[model samples]
Target: MDPWQAGLARELIMRLPAGADSAAAGSVLQPEQLDGWSDLDLHVDLPRSAEPVDLLAGLEIWSVTEEASADRQVLRAVITDGRRVDLVITGGGRVRLPDRAPDNHIRALVAQAAAKLGRGDRLIGLHLTLELVRHCLVQAMLLRDRDQGTTIHRSGSARDALADEIAGLDLDDLGVTPRPNVVERTVDLYARWRSELEPDYRPDWSGLRAVIDRGLAGR
Candidate 1:
């Protein structure tokens, strides 16, 4: 990690409420350790009484990683208190944990990716690429759920209705106007590997790539 980036992450971690555990920071990618990308990932255990939104007030957000399935919401805040920091808050289910719950597909994927990452294999590059794609796809699904006013716990008819509403929304408004074929290709890849990897690993890449493409293109 870059010295400046590590300093920033440490500074942000220090600023969090006392008693915050698991206060560690890492680069977004393994190769980033060589290229110096400097994207920081921080995990903190927040108190139940703590309001993340209130803590994030006035902080300029670089991005928000939303995982409805895990009820994990993270705010990548930049230019806050003169430092850039990524604040990840887990909503009850503790998305950062490496265990699988019945309804938490997003967490399962992340945990699997992290496990692969820890293996230090020669195919780390390929694992990293797949993990990046999976992360983007899951984030897209969570954003879709949020836009449709559905929570991770919602299911049955309510979940189906929300999914339809999300599918019906104008892709352009979400900043995703890319070709459907490309989205489908990524989704198909995700589907093929999802079952082989984890039982809860269901990533709708078609919907996800659209959102990711929009976010990147918009940037």
Candidate 2:
């Protein structure tokens, strides 16, 4: 981590209210490998009621967006220095996702995302696309396990696999996934690997494409 970023983190840790527990996650935990592009990921647990947003006061905040709930708050902020911070504050009511089989999960997620695009929900559509790149694609690659001449089981792996999964796609900050058909191209790449990994199962690629078409066409 940059010394300045580290100092900012320490400042955050120090400013937490009494009885609250906080720790660094993601790249912050690995100080030695920290780079200019890395962001600060902080998870905080609050025992008593407190304003979590108060933590960023007086900082060079460029933009901030948050999700608030009875039990949790998620803050995603960008510093004036261009680094991003993901801060999750939650209590005993923390949520968790159920375990899912890899192939089935990917299929479901892709279909849902494409359908979301068709419904003019571009933000969610892009979010799901990146999610697939960061996670589902990695899962599909490792599950294959044959080409490597070694068994693969974990989520982390070579960078080349990830690059291959996201090839030929222009990821945008806003939710406009058009030109060269980003959704179709990404799905095509995934379906190729998925076919080899689970030949018995089939995903509804065309159906979702129709949804995207209708949504983009404003029907």
Candidate 3:
């Protein structure tokens, strides 16, 4: 339910040549429920009388690859706006929610990232660390939302929840100021996000912090 993707999907359906019955999407993004690391799983149906070529004609696309399928027509595309989309055209269906990375999978990768840093493999370690922060966490958040009945979707939508968690903090809250250092702040943020998941299934926050602290000890 990402507003952007949802709007785009609607625009997509409306623009289709008449007789297009419905559009659908799923997985990853439920903006109200979970707008996190997910993709635009958009699908629409072309009327039996309409040709894909006709539907594609005059539509702006940056690049696309035709996917061969025995049942439906598929096109993997990067639209003009740089949004990657999968155009799945079939008979018709209603537009649905738009799209999990598992917790253990990310935990394992983060562990590798930590180990890499500990071993002086700075480049790979940094790569993993940054990717986890920027991308993987959102996926994990989305999964958590699904598990928790869609109460929290992503970091963007959880401002209220975050505020509640730190309601009466000092003016120089770590979320705002560099309380101790970036590493400690990172640990704190992870601790907050980790709470949304089942304790047993959550990542080892303390373990992660220890690795990072050790990894960055010398420089």
Candidate 4:
């Protein structure tokens, strides 16, 4: 962890309100790999009486908003100190996944990449695109395994397979367009792999293309 992150994490822990079992998560617990841009994640086990929004808002850091999640209340905000914070609040029950985590990751990356493209930041957008492709490949492998009656998480072999498949593709050819040919190809790839697990499933990339186009127009 960066020295500053360690100090800030300690301060955040001390600032936790009473009557709830709260602990630092994410990079806060892994000092060696913590980076400057890493957000501070806090997982809180709270009772019904405690209002999570009020508690986080009381910190006077920034305005907090609740995101729509089918599972539990998710409070998000960026503190004045430039550290993003995500507080996952629960009432003792675990929140089950509405969909696979890899799909959610791709959606988030698409949004972030669109924003970066809007700002005319090609480097970050490309980087995010690369991550999206990698995750898609991993998701494909996971689904493939599930079909064979062997549930397996992402492993090195899966990643290697993805690397081999895309070894000849020119990732740099992707430009700052909402509906880049590469992105369309990626969506097709995702659909092909996902169909192995979900015969009738298809991803909605039109909305993502619109978001990217909007970003480019803003640029």
The RMSD of every model to the true structure, in order and in angstroms, is 13.8, 15.6, 17.8, 12.0
TM-score for candidate 2, please give it: 0.41
Clashing pairs in 1: none
lDDT of 3 at 142: 58
What are the per-residue Cα lDDT tens digits for candidate 1 across 1-219? 345556655555555565555455565334346221134567766654434324443334322344443455564433312233455665342322222234244333332222232233325424544554555455455544655666554544333443443344332221112434222333344454444445565543222332233333321
Best candidate, lDDT-wise?
2
Model 3 over residues 37-106: C-alpha lDDT tens digits?
2235666665455224344444444345554554566765433433445677776322221111234344
TM-score ranking of the models:
4, 2, 3, 1
TM-score of each: 0.32, 0.41, 0.35, 0.44
Give me the runs in candidate 2 sitting further than 4 Å from their true place.
50-53, 92-219
In candidate 2 the C-alpha lDDT for residue 186 amounts to 71
Error of 3 at 97 (Å): 25
Model 2: weakest 10-residue lDDT segment is: 92-101
Worst 10 residues of 3 by lDDT: 92-101
Q: Per model, how many backbone clashes are there?
A: 0, 0, 7, 1
Q: Choose 1 or 2, whichever is better by lDDT.
A: 2
Instruction: Give the number of the best model, judged by TM-score.
Output: 4
Q: lDDT by residue for model 4 over 35-109, one digit each (tens)? A: 434556777776555233344433434223455444467755544333446778776433222223334445445
In order, what lDDT does every prediction score? 0.41, 0.59, 0.47, 0.55
